[model samples]
Target: MDVFDHDAGGISGRRPLVEIEEGAGFPDGLTVDAEGCVWVALWDGGAVRRYTPAGELDRVVTLPTPRTTACAFGGPGLTDLYVTTARTGLASPHPLSGSLLVVPGAGKGLPQPAFEG
Candidate 1:
């Protein structure tokens, strides 16, 4: 498994092929675009950050709730993004977690091939 430092605080030291930028947050889910941009969903931070292929900060998208679980590219043209969020904490007041979200995405998504065996 490959590991990248994305703490974004003052944590120093180089590890492997990945390096985190300054002031970034904890990342939970991640997806790569056709242009090689990385979109990371912050677990507790309640937002997503887009990074360039070279590790530069590009853009950020905010979410309505906290605890984004995962993300992926879907649809026929792959121009749509699907985000999954979790509502881990609750006493049964309202339907919170385990919800699906769809949003507009940039560029085209390649078809995912089925793994053989």
Candidate 2:
């Protein structure tokens, strides 16, 4: 968990911004693409969500596994997306909850902006 401290002009300590449902799982991993789109890996929900800068749901990518862990954009020009997942618990009529995934996307992701002084 990482957070920005506006007053300090640097990244601050960990802070809980949003809490997922109990047992539903927390947000696994996240990354901001070159286009400024935020891609988040949803645990248990088995999907990745791409959000616009305005906090709108631009796209949702479903996964074959049930636990989508983290996501990032990589490859030439940052045009490819890579995702990771965890299969901690799966069996006994439960859904598969762990695996890594990838998908082709449009636009290359940009580097994150540095904290202002």
lDDT of 2 by residue, 1-117 (tens): 234445556566655433444664457788887666677888787777777765667887877777788887777777877878777766632343444466876446775556999
**TM-score per model over all chains:** 0.69, 0.68
Best by TM-score: 1
TM-score, candidate number 2: 0.68
lDDT for model 1, please.
0.68
For each candidate in the order shown, give its overall lDDT on alpha carbons. 0.68, 0.68
- Candidate 1: tens digits of C-alpha lDDT, residues 27-99: 7788888887777777765566677777777877777657777778898789987778877774542254567
| Model 1 residue 73 CA deviation in Å | 0.7
Error of 1 at 41 (Å): 1.1
The regions of model 1 sitting more than 4 angstroms off are 1-25, 90-96
Which 10 consecutive residues of model 1 have the lowest summed lDDT?
15-24
